[model samples]
Target: MDPELLTIVVMNVMNTTRLVLHYFMSCETENDSVVPALLAAMETNNSRLLLAFTEQLHAVDRRYWARETSTEWWDRIVMHVWDDEQWLQNFRMRKSTFLELCAELAPALRRKDTRMRAALTVEKRVAIAVWKLATPDCYRSVAKQFGVGKSTVGAVVMQVCRAINRLLLRRTVTLGNVQEIIDGFEAMGFPNCGGAIDGTHIPILAPDHLAREYINRKGYFSMVLQALVDHRGRFTDINAGRSGKVHDAHIFQNTGLYRKLHSGTFFPDQKIPMGDVEMPIVILGDPAYPLLPWLMKPYTGKLDSSKERFNNRLSRCRMTVERAFGRLKGRWRCLFGRLDLDEENIPMVIAACCILHNICEVKGEKFPQEWSAEVERLAADFEQPDTRAIRGAQCVAIRIREALKEHFDHDSQ
Candidate 1:
């Protein structure tokens, strides 16, 4: 009840009692017993009025101040009842993998209980973050499902994303066993290939400042993710959060991979004899990337049978990276839609998703066939503008491509 209204009611009750007492006193004619009886009656009436007001106030309190507790979906269904298939369907990981992830992230995600409320458990926190990443549900919906506040959902996501990048990124997304990677490519019919490099755009909301810079050739706001994946569809390196307007080749040149390849510090010194030239280990890229001595791209313009066969074989080897990206976006559907996050934090989210992808791939988790349907539509491949390469470098790249073509032709014969 409003305080002013309560005050008015009390005042009216008191005034009525006083008026009755005054009228009884005025009408009294030497009758002391009558005044006493009337005073007792007034006291009883005032007590009843007070009791009624108290009950009304209690009713108002129950109506407006009650708290509605959540249904405890995470505690009831996800923790105890969900099977492995249910876990994969919702969280995009098996039950064992989810527990392992929580254990690994517990050091960073663990929180202390305060007097205000008990802190969310590490498993619950990780589940909240993974649920948000694996699905396109909004924060409020996620909060409702997890029985946490909407803001808590957003905070837990950033917290877990940061933890994953800090602890697991370097270990998971690394160039482990380079010789094995090369051998895998060899089995795929591409000789001396280490990894395949490609770029895809991740959609994001228009920023408050310089929003135009984020718009890609597809005319949608996005951030660029440049990745290097080995032959088994695992990411070896990732560079994310550049503006979509930037070209792939430009982004590649700015990365540490470019520096390592330029300084000859990335790969081993082993080389294979191919006709007059010895071919060093190289990475495969598309025409959008510049041709370098250590980077092999498909032949452009008119091609003879040998060049065509070489392009076909190189493309076959490069498809690993493409499929890796498809699975990444397919499993983590958050990347398929515009991320509702700040531009600065977008990179961490992307990095965390890539790390999770590698973990799932290394663990041999199954990718659902239904998820792949969205890959072709959501994967935006921008056409890069013409890039200028040094004539000396271009000549070396041309010789390497020609030599690889001859090698493929000889194999075909």
Candidate 2:
């Protein structure tokens, strides 16, 4: 046994002794007749009484002092995630990117110096956590790969995820200056287009109480990842954790991004002057999002040649979000399967993935061929119905689509 573990066991025994004495002292006042029987049992080293008391203490003590095995899975597999390019991509990031993340996250994840038993290194803990997000493997499978207990794997996953949420999410996924947004979209041939908006469902184990709430139109339980992606395939804003049952329009309304866009805070109050009217910068969306001055959704139902041309152009721009989501789930394969976590915890994991996606984009991380394969796989399993019924701001939607239609028609001529 490790010296530290032995010391912990001795300390636990001593604490148990004090607790037993306190129980005896309390029993003397409450039940005088029972005290003699308890004393007799203790004196005799009664197996039943001692077993009951020691069993409860042992459960906690064993967990606290659980020894790390000598399997060296850290060196064999975890470290390989950083050293090999193929393995690094399989782990959902590049080598330099993973090390940068470790540097950013290490301070909070590191164990205190005063701990008696040594804890896993910060890099090891983070690698374990990322491997969980990057693959569909469960805790037991992951634990076996890492030579750690399942519960330890679970704890490390959650802890590293929480750190990512607190330290990285807001900083990495952000809406930058309005000019940057405009420039990014304009470079793609859609003038005044700020970004693209869309929603995707991340599969998760259904919650016990509200299982029905998570069932989407496709009949699978999932959590929705409603996002705004820039022209560069980076998420500028994300609203995760909505029930899969919710429509994209409803999810959009619930986000702070919606409030800002609706209130004219997202973009400059200045509007581009057309022949008869002025229009604010707009975000391109499919028919699922409500149309507003600052938001534009394509026309529904039958369309004329001009309208079809406009939709095509708009879709080309809107494909930014689709490709961004594709890369996101491709890089983080855990989103491909039903995440084995509590319902409340599913969002944190998704949010952390999004944050990492943006970091990879910033770092110029290329998606491997495997990422493209995952994208194709996901496209087949995830199907969404067109919810294009005119819900709100129909007049604005029509006028904007008409303007863009005329612009494209003239450009072609």
Q: Rate the local accuracy (lDDT) of all candidates.
A: 0.87, 0.81
Give the per-residue lDDT digits (tens) of candidate 2, residues 1-413. Answer: 44455557656765676678668877637667777776666555545545655665565535355565654767765565435576556666677778889999987899865556567888878888988988878898888877788899999999999999999987899877768878888777677888899988888787898799889888888889999988888998999999988888888887899899889887777678543556788898888877776787777778988778778888989999999998998888888888889888999999999998899888888787867886797767767544545456767656766777787888778
Model 2 clashing residue pairs (backbone): none
Local error of candidate 2 at residue 203 (angstroms): 1.2
On residues 297-350, what C-alpha lDDT tens digit does candidate 1 reach at each position? 887778888778998999999999889888999999899888999999999999
Q: Estimate each model's TM-score.
A: 0.84, 0.81
RMSD of each: 6.8, 8.9
- Tell me the deviation in Å of residue 349 in model 1: 0.4
